[model samples]
Target: MHPALIPEKHPMCGKYMEALVQCRKDNRFSRYIGACNDITYDLSLCLVKEKKIARADRQAQWHDQWRKKKEEDEARMLALKEQAAMSKSESPKEVSSEMQQL
Candidate 1:
């Protein structure tokens, strides 16, 4: 296969891509009989590896963001609970003061 036909998504496989291209050029006739098979296989494997690494990094980042959002939500809920508790504690004094006046 021509190097130009290869996808550009895997920078890590550039060397493998070059090797395959060279093999094809060196064995223009033999290439039709599997002369570049090994190079092509190696390039495919490298691309697969790069893809897996990228997916893992993306997953880790997503998990970190999700954990941070959950932590912030918990803190906000705790703050609201504390605010409610404080208001409840102050209500009885206000009610008693009103009763005394009545």
Candidate 2:
């Protein structure tokens, strides 16, 4: 495979992949006899590491979204409570005026 093509498919393990590909090309006959085993192993390790990093990034993003949503909900609840309190405080005065008018 072309070096450019390998990077496009495995961005994180591109170098390792390309090295293995080159090794195989250099030892075409021995490659089938394990000449490129070390490079293959290294490529697998790189893929695993990249996958772990991706998972951690996704989790962090989800946590941030959850925190923002919780903050918004708390703010909304506080505003509603303040509105309820204001209405409660004003209702008695209006009731007293109505009683006096009667």
Candidate 3:
């Protein structure tokens, strides 16, 4: 899930569902398996209800090229910073060498 999506208020639903599934698989008895299946179905319905709660993405990305452009821009900015730092360090050495030549 995207970071922007609101976290579930009841996070234990998935765990509960998993446990129900496992119990149903291990138990051959009809009553227990039927009970697990019913509970799982109810949990599924409740989880589905969350989709109806309207929410907006905090970090919006409407365009198709947005991700690619963002990545490229970050990479370019980093490269530029590195290049500038390298040039700054090399300049002092070059200046000293020129002074020696004179």
Q: Which candidate gets the maximum lDDT versus the true structure? A: 2
Residues 43-98 of candidate 3: C-alpha lDDT, one tens digit per residue: 66656654433222423433536888999999999999999999999999999999
Off by over 4 Å in 2: 1-8, 11-48
Better of 2 and 3 by TM-score: 2
Number of clashes recorded per candidate: 0, 0, 0
lDDT (Cα) of model 2: 0.86
lDDT of 1 by residue, 1-102 (tens): 334535465578878887887898899899999988988888778877887999999999999999999999999999999999999999999999999999
What lDDT score is found at residue 38 in candidate 3?
Answer: 66
Of candidates 2 and 1, the better by TM-score: 1
Lowest summed-lDDT stretch of 10 residues in model 1? 1-10
Candidate 2 lDDT at 89 equals 96
| Number of the predicted model whose TM-score against the real structure is largest | 1
Query: Rank by lDDT, descending?
Result: 2, 1, 3
Write model 2 residue lDDT over 12-92, tens digit each, in one string.
898888898799789989998889889888887888887798899999999999999999999999999999999999999
Q: Please, what is the TM-score per model?
A: 0.58, 0.53, 0.37
